[model samples]
Target: MHDSVWKFVCLRDLQVPAPCQVAFKWIKLYGSLADGSHSYKIRNNEKHIDWMRIGAFFFDSPVAILSEKLSLPLTILNKDNVEKALESSGACVLSNIKRGIWIADLQLVRCPVCELDTCEGTMQTLEVRNIELFLCDEYQKGSWDYELIGSYTINKSVDAASGGIFDLKHIKDRAMAGVFNLKSWAGKPSDMQPKAMITFHSVAIRTNLQENQGLITKYYAMRAGFEGEVVSIRISQQLA
Candidate 1:
């Protein structure tokens, strides 16, 4: 399999909420590292929740809306049509795509170089190998809102007659935050051929339970809505 395939696999196993939190925290803490980490700040008062973080999760959401359901031809993802997407509601794409939290394992090693079929070169070659990896909240986007609501966290409890506590506990919690969706861009739909359709998988949710007094909250989801062709070219060193 290609390295990218394994990369997606590593990304798929990440647990939700925790991975989401880790991704959000990493971005908030390091997004400005290349420019200046200090330039970025976590907004939304400590008491309020952060919506930008919620938006980030929508970046590469696995969620998608079938074109058949939307009754529209598929849109494409290319340089030209992407602009049309910005103006039309034909398809929805994540905005401000940013790298999210990631975990990877890599190795550095030395190899041999050949000068001729039967001779060795005077220099050594170095190659890097990447393997066995996992990532959580690697990409996200979208906006969120804070609002008041009733929620509950399940817990094990004891049966009164049994005189023994259950292994779980059930608790109710509430809070508020704005909710947003992956929406079709606003304008006339474009006609750019796109490759394989995109959507989200291994879904999950993330939230600040402490503020909600221990409420179970879920992360909003977004899905793509477009149809077209996507082509990839690989330049080879040899003609086959």
Candidate 2:
């Protein structure tokens, strides 16, 4: 068992949807989720859909707007003429969309023994059951747009009966050894709630057998992101 780490980021309004309507958009313009064919391939091969949900500015430094070249180069093949190649090579275009800074809380859980041939093996996975966003007093007056742009679930193995026998004692020992830190990294109070809660179907952890211990640490680790819509919103008497 290991401790859970939390981080924070800022979210900007890329393209405002119609007032009071939520439009979920992909955080990255180019990804498996953006293409139907790629999504199908992932679902078929991996037995799960790999999609990332959240998108925001992750750095703490001041945001800067880099200058874009307005004129084309005279050379037929030059570094400046590689925009199309870059786009084709799966580069993301950072749009100059309306920007807003919203605090995002991230939680990461680490497991000690991710894989074992015996019943002692435990899967380390994080399932974001739901997300609640609590808007500030200013934004609480009127309805706002909420979108569930892109996300997916990965279920490695569902055959509970086929796995090794459940060991309650082993599980208890592991749980006791593990330290969970759900505290906010930004010094926010533990009781603080978000303005909205986004819920989705359960997404399980898909683990892969680690052959090269030198390269990977965990036995099973599925890297995915969560971006979803706000199905419901509740106003809190206390401000976040």
Candidate 3:
């Protein structure tokens, strides 16, 4: 993966470019459970909606404020059960997480694969199932807003049954209007690998920034006066 591409995506999305035109000092990762309570709550806690678990693969960031009351839907396997769980329990009120950092746009995709991991050829498949838009500017310190401009999804599984996370920048970019796509030069598929299961949680923003910290940093990643520029913005594991 070329560092320039990664930097470009990060900078472009934030509407800033590097002085040297080189994207540096940024890292990308697959959004996953943090283990312990975080993961456990989503799986076991039938009474909560963990919006944070949602992926951040966007083709384009919102150029305009799409919605004032960010209300994105989470794709749950047991829609009714999950809804019931949240209605009955308050232990995991995902909606309580800080909005500024905790807010993210979610897109759900399905990749069905063979149960056996011993399959031949590529054991990965992908497809876009749902496209959701979210906004959390109210939950943040300053006026923040982003929207799902466009998105795309491709099924590239040699084996129809080979399961994989259909999570990638290509799909995100297509879904978010090129706002978020994997750095093509990175030599990595823009899609996310599949997981056995997944869930999402949304937390409300607290007045205190520090209390609701670590939700989202990309917001600060780009600013007119910031050191670096947002050369390119494709939502994925990095911003998820």
Candidate 4:
């Protein structure tokens, strides 16, 4: 058995309302399972939540999106058919589409290379082990009401009495800026995808609470309809 099957699930239930004040925080987590860090100011909301891209990801150096579901969408996210138009414009391709936030083998990584069958130090050769049809946000023709919600912080409680999850005293007592992102871009022992959005979430877990708070809150807000209603978030984990 290994400890690599753990997953952090951030579920903002757009269909319901938050139960209490403690539960009504902008960012909330189930446990210390995700890396909620880094706050990203969203400029656009497409049919897909995308891989948390920045800069010229398409027209220039196609950066590899990190596979931290705690922060970025684990799979392809297409709420409508707006981002899909990128395919025709030669921006990207959405491969292995699925319902909701489910991706199919969409995790990208950086493979290294060397002339002597090895890579070392600053003289290393990094390679992007990408797919055939470079997946990107699609259906870019039908989305509106891109409102700006304030930053959300992933508030955690030290007192784990209620389902070992949340409490008020914890937030008031030991709440720091819980931001989850990458502890740098290098992946484990040998895989480096250079995905900046750790979503460890850096809108994610343990430390990434601040970042998680901001991004996930905006996502919840955008999906929950244009304000004026109770925005509810449901966070859980997956031991896959």
Candidate 5:
């Protein structure tokens, strides 16, 4: 097995310079169980979600914001993207995907892998399932504004699995995007909980596969920006 690959011999057969470019988003974790209560009182006690059964959230860094489902997007990449990622490593200089930094615009593909970090609880797995990514912007009450911008639906719904947790990032021209970094350990979970902390950071990415030279040409005409505009942006793991 190649050291660069994940040691999964199944990957030796993948075709390099595969087909297209795609992106992924993984959500498979909880933020806190403090929302629920276990103490039972005659009428005061009420049933809570299964997650509320846990003692407390355990982490050493500022926890990330979880989705409404009370889960964190852990991996977020397409299967094709992963395959392209493996292919790209052949001549890598500074990017090590397994270490979580990726080059922009990998390949066109769908399917996501999820990664988990510093967590505790009755661990469970679906063993088989499908993952997806959706783009959600601002929404107002009584207005339905949403779009399933991306997804990884497969003919065969199976486990989207990954081991351990690792920080991930995307880089281009030395600018970093899609970065996940945990805070320095204040101590062990057994010692004390994470303090409320904040880190100032910036995110930059190339949305269009094209150089977007059109914007420069239309700079004066579209200063207000194109209203009711629909753009399509594609990114993959092989892309850096």
Candidate 6:
């Protein structure tokens, strides 16, 4: 099995507004499922209750998404070539046209170390104390799976000197300072025209927390909107 690590950003700190409502869609492509017929399916499900937080990072890579759903083994296919084939088919081509946060009503819970009240109806918010980067590895000889490898947290006094507002630039810069090897992992490939691909969307929130705690706390406390796209792609040399 091959392992690959990826870096992700929370973009801006997020918070739960009212009733939590975060959603995700999973799309799968079946290439000639033993009948020489092509088919695809889309699933819209709510995010896990424990994951609905402001500063949580998730696996948003295309390789991770494709590896998680495909059941039957198929030959490796290039993404660019797949797109060209769909365009030539004359059918309606669907792709990720819009990026960035679409919704922001994700629910959040306090850290276990903190002595926050659970019964209080007051809105609870949490900051990303440390980001646990996800590592994707090949599983079951053909499928891809993910796990947490390591994490990095910002030092409020060292990183943010001025201490007025948490700098988004500084946070991202620190998060991506290290290098990761992408050549060790495999990518999606198909023998037939792929019917679907996965796309990731983000959601930002405004919180009512305080700013004097620390870097993460202050950042989430201050109501500021930041926007950027954090995406990466890796192709496999081997074929199925």
Q: What is the TM-score of each candidate against the true structure?
A: 0.19, 0.19, 0.18, 0.18, 0.18, 0.20
Write candidate 4's Cα lDDT for 1-240 as tens digits.
Answer: 122121112233221122222221123222211232111112222211223222101111111112113222212232233234322322222122111221111111122122332422111111111111112122122231223322222244221100001111111121112222234432343333323221211112221111121212111111223332211121211111
lDDT of 5 by residue, 1-76 (tens): 2333321221222111211222222111010111221112111122211211111111112111111011122332
Candidate 3 has what TM-score? 0.18
Displacement of the residue 134 alpha carbon in candidate 5, Å: 19
Which run of 10 residues does model 5 get worst, by summed lDDT? 215-224
Best by TM-score: 6
RMSD of each: 26.0, 21.4, 18.9, 20.3, 22.6, 22.9
Instruction: Score residue 163 of candidate 2 by CA lDDT.
Output: 9
Off by over 4 Å in 4: 1-145, 150-191, 194-220, 223-227, 230-240
Q: Global lDDT for candidate 2?
A: 0.20
Model 5: lDDT equals: 0.18
- Higher-scoring candidate on lDDT, 1 or 6: 6
Across 1-240, the per-residue lDDT of candidate 6 in tens digits comes to 111110111232222111122122111101111122110111111211222322223332211111111111112122334434423432112222122222212333333233445532222222111111011112112232221211223343221111111111121232222111111111122212112111122112222222323322211211111221222111111000
Tens digit of lDDT per residue, candidate 1, span 7-118? 3444443321223433222332332222211101222122221111111112123222111012222342233443354236322222222223221111111112222444
- Tens digit per residue, CA lDDT, model 2, 117-205: 33332222222111112221212332333222212222332211000111111212222121111121112333222211111110111
Q: Once superposed on the true structure, which residue ranges of model 3 sit more than 4 Å away at CA?
A: 1-22, 25-51, 59-62, 69-222, 226-240
Give per-residue CA lDDT, model 3, range 48-116, as digits (tens): 222333332222211211110112223321355543443343111111111111213222212113334
Which candidate comes out best when scored by lDDT?
A: 3
